[model samples]
Target: MTGITISKGATVIMHFSIKLKDGTVADSTKVNNKPAQFQVGDGNLTESFENCLLGLSKGDERTFELGPDEAFGQANPDNIHHLDRTKFTAETPAEEGSIVVFTQPNGAEIPGIVREVVGDSVTVDFNHPLAGQTVTFEVEILNVEGNE
Candidate 1:
């Protein structure tokens, strides 16, 4: 701890756990025995998430509760798409709650969850799984570097 704090330009290493409102952990670096490493201002983290870690130093532990807007964000109705049932194959059945991957015109892959399978239609939601839900973050900073 040489007066280095978490801020823009700093690379931080930490263990983190993401928990749902009901206290169920959705993900955790500790589960894999690997701490996360990322730059302070990197686009990997949302502005609100980064703000919660500002000014912290090595060995700092904190927990934060984020609303939907500050977390995964509210679900967008436009992200829901209805496709023809014929588009799906038996191997990847269009069953509700199943995750499916779709390719964009630019050749990028995107994942969506099946919401419903009606007569000739399959509805999918492309929004993040956590969208529209509040979450809790438990973080323990292990190291911070590059912030002079």
Candidate 2:
């Protein structure tokens, strides 16, 4: 099997780190001790991030800096929603940092991260979590191959 570069339909195993413009590490596979697997153009990654991986081989590492728009896009105020506190349970407290999943019409569960906990209310942020922030990624292309 020939190893393909970052083309559409290619499956890639990658270890990546994302840092904010303020130099804070927002996410990193290195810290989690696990790699991520995704197909190209799968919407799991931004186009800019995918573009950066194009033509890279195994063991190759590249870093990219992207603005908010190029990354997760600006954080939309509409992505924030307040829910009633009664909807929470003792096992799933309505507290900041707790994640809640809502069922969509398609029956897919979308997770919203809790942003605030207040009396009779819980604020949930449906944003990508990295939105509204400039970010840098240190990525290592673990593997790639043709899928179609």
Candidate 3:
């Protein structure tokens, strides 16, 4: 490990890729030639995911796999809601397998995928797209800085 290792409160700049079980790339920071910057122990990342960065330093490359429980988590049935077809606008039709954004009472927008559309009812799943799937994380650390 290098002197400035990744730990709680450390800032990290890195490129990462998330792959599914079939080796299909789900997401990658390299897509737009932009790396991600974040501080360790931040709520933006799961505790298990952050733990994978512990002791890593600049110029390090690492890969790890996380199960659903440790990653996006299992899909919750309660998150699936059925709404009337009238609730959808023409611009955002309830098409199966399409993702749609809905505004909550608090004004926060959330994305849900249309699972089915039957007659006057539309079923939408609000779970994270990758929920319940195991994923592999590959990270290349470009820089690491200790907390000030």
Candidate 4:
């Protein structure tokens, strides 16, 4: 039998690493010693990211570079929000460079990074931390199982 290749509906187990343009390691499954397992066509990964794995067989290794728009996407200006200091409690102080989760009206929790804390206002960025940045993605396919 031929080895399985990654495709829609395939369950893939892989080791992956992401690095910034400056060569800073962002994340790595290999370092954690935990291979990532996910089914293709699931919302767990972005379309662009999934595209990189398509047609790859087990034991295959590949590296690709993604632009801002293709990766986390260009940072949206509207995602930057300023909130009143009064809204934060002592337990949840809005410290600069800290990440805090804000509950939306729909009960969805969204994480935002505190950009600056002024006297009475705190600037929060709702954009993904990697947004607007180019990144290098490296992957090694450990296994690929097609849907029966």
Candidate of highest TM-score: 3
Q: What TM-score fits each model? A: 0.94, 0.80, 0.97, 0.93
Q: Give stretches of model 2 more than 4 Å off.
A: 1-4, 146-148
Cα distance off (Å), candidate 3, residue 143: 0.6
TM accuracy, model 4: 0.93
The sequence of per-residue lDDT tens digits that candidate 1 reaches over residues 16-111 is: 999998999999999989999999887988899999999999989999999999999999999999999988888778999999988899999999
Judged by lDDT against the true structure, how good is candidate 1? 0.93
Question: Tens digits of per-residue lDDT for model 2 on 7-58?
Answer: 8878999899999888898999989789999998899987888888878877
Better of 2 and 4 by lDDT: 4
lDDT of 2 at 41: 88
User: How well does candidate 1 match the true structure in TM-score terms?
Assistant: 0.94
lDDT of all predictions: 0.93, 0.86, 0.95, 0.92
Quote the positional error of residue 57 for candidate 4 in Å. Answer: 0.9
Off by over 4 Å in 1: none
Q: Any idea what lDDT model 3 has?
A: 0.95
Error of 4 at 44 (Å): 1.4
